[model samples]
Target chain A: MITQQDFEQIQDAIAGKLSADEQQAYNKRLSTDSNFAEDAFLQDKLKNILSDKPFDEFRGTLMRIETEYHYLGLWRTTETSETFSIEDILAMFEPVAHYEQALSHADLRAAGTALLQPQNGSNFLPNDTLTFAWAAALTEPLVLSIENNQEDVVLQDTIETGTVSHNITLPNLPAGRYYFKLTGNNSGMYIGMFFVNKNLLDEL
Target chain B: MVTLQQTQAFMNSKHTLNSNEQEKNTRIIDGFKNNNTRIIGECYAEMYPLIVRYITNNSGDETTAKEIIWECFEVFFKNCTKPDFVLNAKFSSYIHSIANNIWLKRLRDNKKYTYTDITITESSRHDFDDDTDNPYASDIDDYTDQITETIYENDLSHVIRQLLLELTEECKTIFRLKHEEEQSHEEIASLLQISIDMSKSRLYRCSIKMAQAIKNSPYYRELIDGFPFLTNYTNKKRKS
Candidate 1:
């Protein structure tokens, strides 16, 4: 739970605007407090993403394409290519997820992390319990977060342990895809995507 | 501030695409238009590690490196979509160079990456900080200025703009003013001719509708799921 003041202090620290004592305190928190460190990393990420001009333009344009993609390629039955079907869109998204997982392999290799169950492109029932596993022998905790496309964090927490697996009973998760990012110890970031089928995943 | 044209020109001028390369460029553009994730994914797989290595080798932390690599991806994708866009060199090399350029800018602004052995290359040279480009005459200028304002100031995505469009016109105005313009609720209320309390209520309503829309829209469902930033914002907002 990052307060507004923590947000400001993190920004100030990132900007090098903090006074010596302030900087010292911030640095102390970064090293000793896992939550503080995660918050700092998240804040820095937001700042970098928001500060970029050229990239946002590209994203905006690509989204515009996405808004109209169904109208092209497969749905050109009539003059209005603007029309879209959900199934067609989902089909198109398949490769997007595929490639994303492929790209993530690089980072996962670097971090020595691998997502086991609900693997990329794998389907799971909405009601089913999900198990997330990673390969690790860490001296420090790692922050695992599941985020939506809107850049919002749905599930996030610090994973503290030598144990390498986590089993979670998802609370009626909305059906769709999600990005899971694992970060800690200032080593490397491991990113991947998974899908939740709208069909009720049975809790057996 | 960079106009879209100047940005295009700066990018296109960097490399001269041969006739064969032009067709390949077209295919790449087609790939993006068709949501050909394989091409983009391939680029990311090959390029992300290169960037990570570059960033960690310098004074930067892994966090900053991930940010820069994502930035490079965005820039590369955007450049691929431009009307006069070209790939004069190898796609991997081009994006790698752009990543290099982005990192140097990051280092300059932060003054944190005090590198001892990294030699600056031609790709490291960029004038993103320069404010020389000017918008031209007429309503085109107005539109261009609006875009310039959005890019240089707002730095948000089209998805957000689309979300705001889901609101009523008045609510949209209030949100644009409050979020992008950074206006106070009092100011937004004054400008919109609504009470301060009403302004807050409308903002709250707008947020709810916005979230609902993201949840409902399949376009967003497929996208938002894979994007951490959007979900994080809503999750944090829900907590707040």
Candidate 2:
């Protein structure tokens, strides 16, 4: 039963646009007439509902970022690479650990590898200092190799025997996944991976 | 593998973060308060591992960890946006505490898992308990209250937003201009290349349609039923 005029008056009153006399009249009708009061109340609620544009926009941004994260394989199951082909795993930035687990059990025992830092499938900023460690008792020299997804060696280093750990300050690597391999003359090779996320760097 | 000394050393490392690290924390908190997408994404990347580690170490899995973290972020984001909100701890620590609380509540609700008392870590415990450092020392209660209010408002807004989408494109544009941009009818008419009268009439018609739709909705009826003051108006409308 509220007319266009009534609705306009209610909006004007809510916006505090009504003149002194008009405001007084609107207040009287609001107190005396339940219908008008209800209309006004609903109008006020509608205005509030319409003002949620910022929240709606924020949710849109969150969804976009979530989709990007999912595409980066951040939300994948922590299963070993046994479930996926090498090509399938390599196609995305897989954050799985112990890629060597994909090898046969005999190769694993023969490797006699020590614990490695970064445990594979971890994310790091470009400027982060990574600690690469291996077993200390081995007398042979170890070669540390880091390769990009394209199989190009981006970084390589040599470690002398008796060195348990080496700290390397990472270069400003672009955002993507990179694989690192540690090969000892007498021990098994250790393969691990990490991601240099530009988004994390930009945000920080 | 983790000894008490190692844990203490790790905590000490956190406290002794370099100036750049402290600056990074400040930027993250500022960006979070401002709703920066890049910062939010960074938060996910940095904190997700900690959440997953904690959840997996307890009685939860990756999927449950994801759900709880998302829910905690939603609530945490809302709380951070409040004008009076003051975070006394690291942003990550605050969110981790929220995730812990939410996971514990979920476990308690499911009742299948035996209630194991999960202790809050040292950093988070200090953040939660120290009133001098934390402005919102009683934030658990505040968060609960805000969450309830957010649920109600979000539900109502979501329904209204869906209905608004059902409107004609022109009607939607008019609503956006009038409500969001606060454009007057004259300005709207000028922008839309329509007469002022046409602009005014279209807006009025749109508003009426929205009002009628809301009035007939089951959600609106439920809302009114819960609010006694609104129920008085419903009773009068019924009598009329």
Candidate 3:
């Protein structure tokens, strides 16, 4: 059994955390002694451990960041301000897709809807796009503003799917951040916010 | 994410024993236990990735690798701070060695040992005492030459990354600090609120696991063939 003193001394030397004299002494003794094979083995192992990895395995760690959920949401009724957690709703959506194609194409809004209220209530919808309008409603409200060269002329159309699209025209509007507030005429209210660059639009 | 400086400071601090680091370890042996997360967290902050890399590099799935690594640390930490326990080596090497043993034993137990055409021998002998100043000088040169030749050919790194993804959050943290940050076991122990012995053991087991992982992998085997020191050494001392 190695003595604590010896072990500590050996460790200190190996770590290169030792004093000059101690280090020199360790070097001298190790050079001549075969019995110190254990120490040599330890050093060899340390070298193996510390040796520059010719292969960059550490880079693989970066991939983990993608797996984390950047956004989590609470679903809101399309008709009411009442809020409820969609966790149970999400849990019920089982066998929504194959194990590999887990990421649904739907955005957060769509994913939120699928997670909150599954269509069959039997299958788990993994698609991100499936959440759609209900998901947009669930996210806390955000204000969206569109700056145009002219504020008077507006293009508004309600798609047959009940989805509404608004195109406002403005002349000489400066480029800046904008917020929009969306309210459904029906019981379901949905809000979506995005940034618009008038300068870029003007060029087009 | 435990900084090296933070780990150093923790090594010098006296707050851990006063806290429940020991208490939690005790509970692990008896049943499920949760302790000071931040402290326990330090141990895993960097260790997780190392474990994953080791397993994945060798040839194991991430889930099995993560499970094995976690189990090794859990058992190691549970006994690390026992007043009677003493740390014998760098936590990194210790943890790696233990993990390697565990993985090797598993492979052996499962009868998965196959003669991969590389003949392992116990025939060659060297004269230099391993502890001497020039002990491994020749070996190093040979290993370096082999590695330098194959630097561009091996994809051992890709396999390692695939396995790393399977590790738990705790395991990743531990691996980062130990391997990437190069912190010592004592420092890691205090930062993680685990025993110094536990930290060392984890590192040892992690290394062993990784080595095994690499050895078991066909890609790693092909690469190691070009790595003279690793190949020659194993052929002489660790033949299958």
Candidate 4:
């Protein structure tokens, strides 16, 4: 079993604190004993880590900071004021939309809404109940509204469960490009569009 | 609505830190490490609205917003102390990613979130950045394992630093002066209003306590038992 002395010896050897004669002896043990060699290698890794001044400095800074917190009694709430609303905390981040993508005119209508059932530009019967998809899983009920090219609301309904996908029936009207908007409980709005197959209706 | 240009400008500004800017960043980082409540509070207050908007805009209430935002703050503070950490962007953007991931994970857990074949918006794409260095594919818990690993692998020195920080006030001061600042026992004693002999002995005891803590750590136990180096090395040797 490796004793404390073995550990010390390994550490010293790795740090080059061992004398030439002592180093030679340490190397001898490494060549002779496999276990000692493995321990020595580990000690070497530890030595490298320990000697990292930048890392150690960072650690020292953290310790001082932690200790400072202890004295300040800031572990809980502020002594001077009442706890504030959490929404106030978000101000620390610079308000920015990092997610922005240029979209085609058709995709622009969808406005980056998650779509599952109706493929964009696909032909659908006017009387069909098309399955709608949204990328976000919202617990609150949402409103699904469909409008024609003239921006007239054709179908508007409330879905109780913001399931991954839901079926929404279309109003039997002239086949044309229809834009859809999905809005959840203060969650914001997402949009997409689908086409009513005028030719398919003619065939029928 | 922060644009990509704004984000690039913020990150780019970090490369040009004047003395005041450097000092301010240091103070903020130092305040967090030390748990200066005022600094932390102000920071929390500032970040709260952003978190609230994100959560509220996604069907969440204030309570849910508070829990996720606070958790993200803890992670953000710890991340700031990472050695040689570069300020690559507005720290808010980084926090934004973490908070968003946590909420997304929460939604998935409650079965409110689902995957679809639709194209992702810029908002979802911005979530690719992670602050915690968490390697997990999904944005959720298993945080206890990570906490242990952080002390062991990612921040062993920092763990020791924390342990030292947790010592009694006298011990903390004496140990910091003695070891970190390399102050002579006489200097420490005079500065802290203690006898030189007392200072020496206190430093000694504090060192022993730290050593004990290290030895008692589960990571050290595994290391001592040859679980990592020894077993692996022996197996490799045997194979060879």
Whole-model alpha-carbon lDDT for candidate 1: 0.53
Candidate 2 chain B: 10-residue stretch with minimal lDDT = B122-131
Measured with C-alpha atoms, the lDDT of residue B14 in candidate 3 is 23
- The residue-by-residue lDDT of candidate 4 on A1-204, one tens digit each, is 355567667656644688878877777677679767755554444334444454554444444333333333222344445432222222211112211111133343222345555665556776888887657554677788887766678889876654677776776755456666777755566555566753422232
Error of 3 at B161 (Å): 2.8
- TM-score of the second chain in each model? 0.43, 0.53, 0.34, 0.42
Per lDDT, the best of the predicted structures is 2
Question: Could you tell me every candidate's TM-score relative to the true structure?
Answer: 0.30, 0.50, 0.26, 0.29
Best-to-worst TM-score order: 2, 1, 4, 3
lDDT for each residue of candidate 2 in B185-204, tens digit (9 for 90 to 100): 99999999999999988988
Number of the top-ranking candidate, with DockQ as the measure: 2
What ranges in model 2 sit over 4 Å off? A24-38, A49-53, A74-204, B1-29, B42-79, B86-139, B227-240
- Candidate 1 residue lDDT tens string, A1-204: 555467557757767788888877777676667566655654454344445454555555444433343223222322432223444345423434443755556545323545454465566555677676666654456787876544468788676756467676555655556666777665566666766752222110
Assess the local accuracy of residue B134 in candidate 3 as a C-alpha lDDT between 0 and 100. 31
lDDT of 3 by residue, A1-204 (tens): 334455556556546677777766666555555334333333344343444352122222212211111122212122333222223223322222321132332333321232233221121111212122332332232222321222222223232232222223333322322222233334232223222332222222
Winner on DockQ between 1 and 2 is 2
Task: List CA RMSD, all candidates.
Answer: 25.7, 15.2, 22.5, 24.5
For every candidate, how close is chain A to the native chain A in TM-score? 0.44, 0.45, 0.28, 0.40
For model 1, what TM-score is found for chain B?
A: 0.43
DockQ-derived CAPRI band for the predicted complex in model 3? incorrect
Per-residue lDDT tens digits of candidate 1, residues B1-240?
999999997654554445664575567667655555444444444455566666666556767866766666565565555576545454545555566556654454344555553455433222221112311101121122222222222223444445545578876676567544667779988988989988877765554455455446664443433334434443342243
For each candidate, the DockQ is 0.04, 0.14, 0.03, 0.02
